[model samples]
Target chain A: MKRELTCIGCPMGCRLTAEFNGTEVTEVTGNGCAVGARYAREELTNPKRMVTALVRVVGMERPLSVKTEAPIEKRLVFDCLAALGAVAVAPPVRIGDVILENVLGTGVNVVATEDIGG
Target chain B: MNMKTKRVDLLIIGGGPAGLAAACAAREAGVTNLLILEREDALGGILRQCIHNGFGLHTFQEELTGPEYAARYIARVQELGIPYECGAMVISLSPERRAVYVSRTEGIVAVEAGAVILAMGCRERPRGALGTPGWRCAGIFTAGTAQKLVNLEGRMPGKRVVILGSGDIGLIMARRMTFSGAKVLACVEIMPYSSGLKRNIVQCLDDYGIPLLFNHTVVDIHGRERLTGVTIAEVDGKKRPIPGTEQEIACDTLLLSVGLIPENELSAMAGVALSPATGGPVVDETLATNVPGIFSCGNVLHVHDLVDFVSAEAARAGEMAARFLSGEKTAGERIPLIAGNGVSALVPEVLSKRPEADVTFMFRPRAVYRNARIAVFRGGKQLAVKRARILAPGEMAEITVKQDAFCESEGELTVSVEEVGA
Candidate 1:
């Protein structure tokens, strides 16, 4: 399968075109550099992404926004958000405070980015 | 038709970090008569809306919020009693560096300057500009506007949100909305990876558990009265949405933080040559635009990721503009700046013809790299080289090429970045 992939891994926005002979990769072009090629291959085979969103909070003005401690399985973003919906944090939250421990049993802790004053 | 024309030793446009710093620097450099014109009523530009603390970590060695960081310099501008006009919008610039400004009550006013600094910062890109298929609705707000509404105006625009684009503003807003009692449904990015800093990705989104939908886009906006929901689809390798993968996510607001374009209409009207790479005026090391008397710096020269760098660059432009007014002469044989492979754009579009000075160039990489080498060449002869252990598009790269490379020689200078060993 011949495919074109855009390298959005960073600000460069590299345009990449790739050729795959069956399940094996063949050639890549239009990439400004090699990292784009690597991104394209990984993106085609096993795409990964960092997830961010919000969970409910008690005694606070609004919900507490949170993100996975690290990159989770890219395919599980929806499942992760579903899990985050039921989670909630209390007020007087400090930046870098852990809101959830062992999120989805992935050993990743959902943390807070900003301090919430009570 | 004779407008009120005032004369000043130096005139700086836009009252952002760059403009304020430029005015102060020029004043300290023995230029007494200086004027700064700002369109907004306030002095701080985009920084005013950024309520989150994280700024001044590098420059001040302490973390400060955007307004706090701005106040530090604004205080200096006040202490120096710098002359400035708020609510003054510069409509045009002459080739000779005269600024035409208009205010509601003041009407049309023109200011002739011995030197002018163009500090007009950049503007955000909206969803309509991306050619993305979506209904034009009331819920769409640029990340900055949304930031202004929530952080400054103290108004909650929506209770449920869907953000498009993962730039710093959008990413930061994802966290902000969650704190503002809104449910951020998801952040959709058409690209496979994020365009924001690693720290932001980790700190802003990861901490909040906000769903950042990567390689996805909002194909349709569902509400007509207000925002009801959004249709998001997974984009393939080519960034086109893959069919049968559409997922409807319920949301009331759609925030766009796609990108920024330098606000350079005045430069354009003045006939200053612009670089296609950065969409800003082509400037020499002195930050002088193609038009000798008109100078530009900060985000107006090129979009900068950090405000500290913007201030530093603007100070240089301010200092050089004062020198120009004091009879600093430019020699012939100015070298035009050219971008090389793996390099998106280079600033200070021209290099000085003299040998004793050092000229700095800020650039963005074309892709992510583990080990890279940035090299500067004149007429195909390598002039300067620097090594980078890691490089990413989110970060800006600065390199200074020695003035000697262009002193004795004349021609185009090319700045290229390449992966090590490749």
Candidate 2:
């Protein structure tokens, strides 16, 4: 099977072609750089994306912004958001404070990216 | 009934990425008494709400979210002990660099600064700007407002959304709303090509199987109290709605991400000359407005597509502001930097004759061009040329002219794009 993808590695946005055989070994072409090639391979195998969401904060009118330390599996993105939808933390929250630990057993922690104080 | 007065070597407006970076750079360049006024309750203006990743790639050489990118600079500012006041709204600024502001803690404070840097960024073009035939609906929100509501307030604006304009913010929101379990019906753009980056078009819309309708616009809106749906129609080349091409997509919310306009009311109050093309301040090479001792950078100078570029440009503005404060000599005899064929707008509207250093000109093209050559001309003579594989209006392009090339050339520097093998 062949799939055409746009490499988001950089602003260049190179159009890439990926050749796969039953989700097996393949060749990737049309990438502008090595990073684009690696991105294409990883995308075909196990696509990952960094997840950002808001966690409810007490004593504050607005919620605190949080994100995963690393990119999680693409398939688990909505699930992770669903998990975060139920979570809330209290302020005096500092940046990098862990909000959800080992989210969905993915071993990725969602940490606060903003400081919200009471 | 005496008002308080404070003096600083430099006063920066807006404490977002541009202002923070400018403050740090100015301080490092030997300006000690620097004050930043931010209207927000905290630092990191818009970045505080932009939690999505894909920022700071050019500056940090790594992928970072908006807040993460902002935190890096916020930490630096704190470490440098740069004095900044949050919740301080600058009310007026004079041509003499005198500023009056009001805050909850400080009532009616004034500041006299040796140099002023206007970093007050851009704001989204609201629904009123488009004049869509619709009632004053409650569910219709600007994309940035929705972003703030979703990412900052932890509130979902609506369950079903129809986004107008495929700008980056709108494209990102389409995916964001989808991830939040909201059904995004369609993203409509009146322009044939998207005004967003290609990566956003792919990662945000294409990844989720969301439909992107080009050359289409929402002509009419339906809703009495809240948004019920929007009538989208295909537009001709002149952007006129084609009859019999109207389609109604039922959705409770409508998000507009049409465009961003530089917030330059403060700049105007300072008597800075404005650029009608850029909708910002007209600036020289050092990002200095025609108003002496006043400099502008970031989105306040021109709407920038990337925050990384905003930081880079504001850093230059900070350094220049420092030089102005310290009585350093600068280039003389300004020359106009003209945007010619296929170019829409150019920053630093004029170039200063810096004999020792090269000057970079940043501009956006009028449309998408493949295999194009960006040529710089002076006195009708070609000075330099840079080949580009592709150029798009969404992405800003830059080209540097060596000091030797510039020093030898005369007259206004005109930059234009030519199609290769055309």
> Which candidate number has the best lDDT?
2
What TM-score would chain B of candidate 1 score versus the native chain B? 0.96
User: Every model's DockQ, to 2 decimals?
Assistant: 0.05, 0.58
Which window of 10 residues has the lowest lDDT sum in candidate 1 chain B?
B198-207
Candidate 1 Cα RMSD after full superposition onto the native fold (Å): 9.5
Instruction: Give the backbone clash total of model 2.
Output: 0
Query: Which candidate's DockQ is highest?
Result: 2
**TM-score for chain B of all predictions:** 0.96, 0.98
- Cα miss at B175, model 2 (Å)? 2.1
Q: What would the TM-score be for candidate 2 when compared with the true structure?
A: 0.95
Question: For residues B49-158, could you state the per-residue lDDT of candidate 2 as single tens digits?
Answer: 78888899899998788988999999999999999999999999999999999999998999999999999999999988887998998899999999988887778999
**In candidate 2, what are the lDDT values of residues A1-118, reduced to their tens digit?**
9978888875668889988775653888998779778888888888888888877787677877889989899899889989998987987988889999999999999998877884
Candidate 2 docking quality: incorrect, acceptable, medium or high:
medium
RMSD of 2: 2.1
Model 2 residue pairs with clashes: none
